[model samples]
Target: MKCILFVFGIIALLLCATVQAVDKSACSQPHEIGPCRKADPKFFYNSEKKACEDFLYGGCKGNDNRFDTKEECEKTCL
Candidate 1:
């Protein structure tokens, strides 16, 4: 009985490890328009354009493709 319980516990742990929570917005293309900084330089990964494009944030509209650098955006999204 003890051995069976231990195996079950291990299985539960493994299952938990396999499950990962992903942000749909971040991965999705077609960014939003608000909640960004204009002066703050950033790179956004455009899935449709299939490239990291430089954008001037309106300080109130943008999507989850926000990145600090173009390379960083490609590394993560591309």
Candidate 2:
């Protein structure tokens, strides 16, 4: 029983390590421009600005536009 538990623990550790490696590769890269607001309420990709821009501006009276994922936002914007 003890041996079986030990093996299971090792396998779990290995699986966790593999998952970490994959996540590291996926989230390792950095973004350039960062998050920006292109539209108000709803946000979309802004290729030219390099930063997310608000959908609405100038006293529109709405939630501030921002990207949830900084890296993604920067990557798309920048």
| Whole-model lDDT, model 1 | 0.67
How well is each residue in 1-78 modelled by candidate 1, as lDDT tens digits? Answer: 999999999999887655422333474666554664456667777777778887666666566667778877776666
Cα lDDT of model 2 by residue, 1-78, tens digit: 999999999999999988756544422233223344443233434444544543332233332233455565444344
Error of 1 at 44 (Å): 0.9
Q: Candidate 2, which segments miss by more than 4 Å at Cα? A: 28-78
The lDDT of each candidate is 0.67, 0.47
What residue pairs clash in candidate 1, if any at all?
A: 33-61, 33-62, 34-60, 34-61, 34-62, 35-60, 35-61, 36-59
Q: Cα RMSD for candidate 2? A: 10.3
Deviation in Å, model 1, residue 36 alpha carbon = 6.2
TM-score of 1: 0.53
Q: What is the Cα-based lDDT of residue 50 in candidate 2?
A: 41
The model with the greatest TM-score is 1
